[model samples]
Target: MTRIPHETSGEPNPLRALGLDTLRRRTSMKWRTYPEDVLPLWVAEMDVPLAEPVVRAVTDALALGDTGYPAGTAYAEALADFAGKRWGWAGLAVERTAIVPDVMLGAVEMIKLVTGPGDAVVVNTPVYPPFFEFVTHMDRQVAQAPLGPDLRIDPGTLEESFRRAVADGRRAAFLLCSPHNPTGTVHTAEELSTVARLAERYGVRVVADEIHAPLVLDGADFVPYLSVPGGESGLSLMSASKAWNLAGLKAALAIAGPAAGADLARLPEEVSHGPSHLGVIAHSAALRDGNAWLDALLAGLDDNRSLLSDLLAEYLPGIVHRPGEATYLAWLDCRALGLGDDPAQVFLHRGRVALNSGLPFGTGGAGHVRLNLATAPEVLTEAVRRMAAVLE
Candidate 1:
């Protein structure tokens, strides 16, 4: 990891001197109405403005009054180009790519399509709650594979779990989160390869959620699952929504490889005749031209992440983190703090900060909370200060 240069004296972070301060100043004027003096560090959204490309795309779409369904070939070329430039892998075969409303919808659809009722779907515990929600909601049996202390999938244990499920005739699919949410640990290419092997061995399909791929900070590279060796056999779901703050627009691209691709390729022919015109346009612009703004945004996030790490080390010692590799979400172990009951509630009602309780993340997430550091450094600093005051 590269260390950012700090000033010799009371070094001021460049992000603070940049647009972050301005953003906070405007947000503070109406923040109280939303959370009442509390920082909203719960959701996976940045407080920064959108990239110019994204803005221009949306604006142009509105200007042209092109509200109809998008043509198939338009965003396909953009996605293919983005994938090639970003990951150095290509041959996306746009014919197999389908636009979905969002990641959650894609996940649900994949689960239903891959497995049937009574079959088991494997997912690591302390994951993005929706992983569990999708399986259970579909009335399918869920196989919980808890992540180990490093907050990563334990291969040995995972292998055993898969064996048990297969023995029971319940094994069918695995729901995987890459650059995993909450914890923010980007899985190594080797790690993804192992997962592919597991899927091959157990005859289970893998559903990789890579929604947070673009949020990787400070020159950190994001690896697409399909880019990994033998990844062409797995399913990769990706989008520009998370990092580009296009969630409201509701668009995600699902790439199907030989193993899972063959199954998903029928999506366009079977359902949702075409992609959303607005989503396609916005996604195309962001991927094709958003690099400059993305670089600056990542720099700002790095500063905020560094400030939070320093503050946690100094003021809230003993709380542990896994060293975030991607995304603004920070998974913190607050068991040492011993804030009774849901820590999120305690912070909101008392500390006046809103954080996502770790409980929903699964077993290991019990004593933790997910913090979103996408806001300005000033807001995060104030939130930490208030938290310290409560604990002190």
Candidate 2:
């Protein structure tokens, strides 16, 4: 096992420290989904070691034979403390938060709280793929409100979508992805306030998926939706999974705004049964004691983001990539490569580089691909080189 440095000690970049040989040996979807010859950079999983605190907490619990159903509000409290110290927002009320299986499950429950089967759920297009899948699977219609040219929420477009969504007195819900996936646009407090106002005016409920909140890189600030004025009726789901690389540990919190407390209360009690007790312990430990490790990870990611930009400019000059303010995912515009609608397929077959096809991200996603950036710098450089070779 590689010796991961302690938080207090200055350590090398985590993303670069993990060797490719070690990574390929793992059996996660990111590594096993493709052939050995292909370079996989499509999923949200990071190729780094778990934070020391998280590992210690989980192992301690296992040693004591303490695996049982999750209980208590420790997870919520830990998150509340982290949010206050990190984002300077004290709006997280532990009393109004509930434990759920994961971010997507929490989102499904939040959407169900204020909406009924067959109602409309509005989403920003070229957004997360699961936003469409999970909502549709729940028997709700998905309305597209594609992002503006700058990839930020367009109020005019959003308002229009909201109007159409609630037509005929139908109750609608807006599913917001904060520090949004793929594109990684961090929503400002001002932008969230506007969304709250629009949702209020159009009578649409807002359910924010803030799973990537803790992963916001430099030059960006994450605004909790519930902290904004007029956002009292909104709901947000957050977790330490993304930041601590704890996705396999299924746990998340669904927090309701002051005005939506009643709706959140109506969530079925059985929903809490989905998360693993060990997952709760790991997530709680991450929120409370993983800050030092998280800080180190963020610094490494910032460097990777810059390195990716430079690599793209030199190898794939025609590809347009607006460096995102958050998340380890990079959305690349491959239209200029003349690879047609789904360029990812071309890269996979010709370059042996696996990337997420943009088509599933909904409208405005074509001629694009999403690449994961949470890997060793050498792996990222080689992936870009392989992709560029396809065009040659």
Candidate 3:
């Protein structure tokens, strides 16, 4: 298995710097001291190599020399199998699934399908940046329901937005992320039901992004929004990108239930057609056979996260890590540490670790920084060491 060099270290192992190599290679710098020795804890891509099954699948596809349009039922069948075996919310068939280029495309298309320009698209702030653009770029209005301090949705605020939109008689839609980005909140089943009921009652189409659903960490179960009662009426988008580190492959499935599913399937033929041949192949391999490798990767991530938590406690004790139930990203509240202005910038310039500025995740994310812990321990440890040195 061709893996990053840092991934193979032994016990007393230095933290494996997953993206550091790529960062170093791109910046033309060396480890731990190049102009402040920047450690990149941003970007969600894993430093580890592809799972063996994924590699084999891609290799076989390449060997066949068939890099044509990925029009087929296999990818959809694979997705259906994954949804059933993993989440237990059925009612999905291959015909109801369309192979899209990526989650973003599916999302933008869903919003466009459900609403027109000047209509409203509601999103929880501090969301994936693209959600903002997906709505605004289309000349639609964006309703930001910022999360409260607990890092969960402020249902009160969201309800207010819905009421306002309905009162104005404007069409509305919702763009939701499960195992949400940056914040790493795995929304509870009951919460999802509530959200669904809101959408149904308000006549808003819900576009649920479950791209990170496969990587629920810390013993939490990954609940598909559609699996909850009344959830099938919403649109669900999933991908192999996060779990298998296959974002470059660009394959994702958009499933609509008998209710929303039919509307989704009836989307423009341009969007409903097949996916990338490579993406389809990679996704199929990931869903059908990447469980063992995923387990190992999760174990590695769990260990890395534990190390991060312990170090933050011991060194940067002032920083708060909103408990991570899913996703490799950690939302660090650096406000308590008194890092002036933007902690992300302070960490980048002083601590030499590049983290996602919290402001982008939404209102409550301000003064927070998101760190990607999907790398090797040696790398993460070194990053923490640098961060601790700057603050300690």
Candidate 4:
């Protein structure tokens, strides 16, 4: 696959950011989930406009009436190339990659292929809600390891869970969330190396959920799992969905490291048949031609992350807010405000603002809410204002 690099300034130019009226017109779940009176900022979807390359690719596909089943290895090749350029990941093996319907589905299938029925799947607590849901959906048991005080994975707790997972001579796998969701904590190379070593010692396979790799904001470096020394036996589920705002596209890739290639090859062929053709096309184009657009989006999101910090400090001074280094989600700690375990309920009922309930995110989620920071600056400003009004 051929790729063209588009140079971009690291800082966001204000002119490129979206405005309030342009965003409110969106008909996505973020907008439609709440009544017009409430300011919605819960869902993972972004309020920004689509990238030009992505839009053009989808439009061309529709014009050609190319809506059919997905084919070929173009998507994999494109991502491999993008990975090399974006994150210094030069070890991407296109032939060892398999396309799937989406990241969660790809992860579940990868878990099934590597481990038997009733195998335990370990996950970090207060993580993405689907990590909890998909493990149960596959009939595998879920093992929880709560994050440390800084919201990063706890090494000691992780080892304990790994030991418990295979205690009875049972098989297990770690569903590692890189640049972790809800909290948006980007894992460092050292942290991932530790996880890889731990997995090796525990006789467990590691499947990294790296769907957020491309969205690592300034000051945080995204290290691909397979690029780590002890990670050659791990598997990775990647997609353009999260970063490119293409979640509804229905396409993702399950990648295997050199040592794990044979295991991935064992994946059921029916799994590869699930991706949509247009989704594959859009993803490929995004990887090949969407870097400049992606850079701009990242710059805007960087501004928003900083913007949220200011907004929180000014309005909701009691709430603990950590500006995320990656992802558009801000995990807010509302414990100091005495909002109970699920503050989202309080915000919606009193402040008329919709935010993701942190309760469903598993352990350590009490007294928290996941605020989507991908909207226009005005929307974020209003969300905090509403939240503060209720407290006042």
Using alpha carbons, what is the TM-score of model 3?
0.90
Please identify which of the two predictions, 3 or 4, would achieve the higher lDDT against the true structure.
4
Every model: Cα RMSD to truth? 4.6, 3.9, 5.3, 2.6
TM per candidate comes to 0.89, 0.97, 0.90, 0.95
lDDT of 3 by residue, 69-136 (tens): 87768877877777676666556667667778788888887777788889988888778877876678
Local distance difference test, per candidate? Answer: 0.75, 0.92, 0.77, 0.88
After superposition, the stretches of candidate 4 with alpha carbons farther than 4 Å from their true spots are 1-25
What are the clash counts of all predictions, listed in order? 4, 0, 14, 0
TM-score order of candidates, best first? Answer: 2, 4, 3, 1
Q: Native-vs-model 4 lDDT? A: 0.88
Give the per-residue lDDT of model 1 (tens digit) for 1-392. Answer: 12232212232322344353354465332333444456677877667667777888889889989888766665667877876766665757787677777777777777667778877878887789988787888887778888888888899877776776678666587888888887888888788888878877987878889888877765556777876776776677788887777776767777787556668855644445434678878887888887666666677778778899898888788678666888878988888888854677777788888889898887787778889887778788888877777776
**Top lDDT prediction, candidate number:** 2
What is model 3's C-alpha RMSD? 5.3
Please name the candidate that would achieve the greatest TM-score relative to the true structure.
2
Model 2: clashing residue pairs? none
Candidate 3, after superposition: displacement of residue 389 in Å?
Answer: 2.2
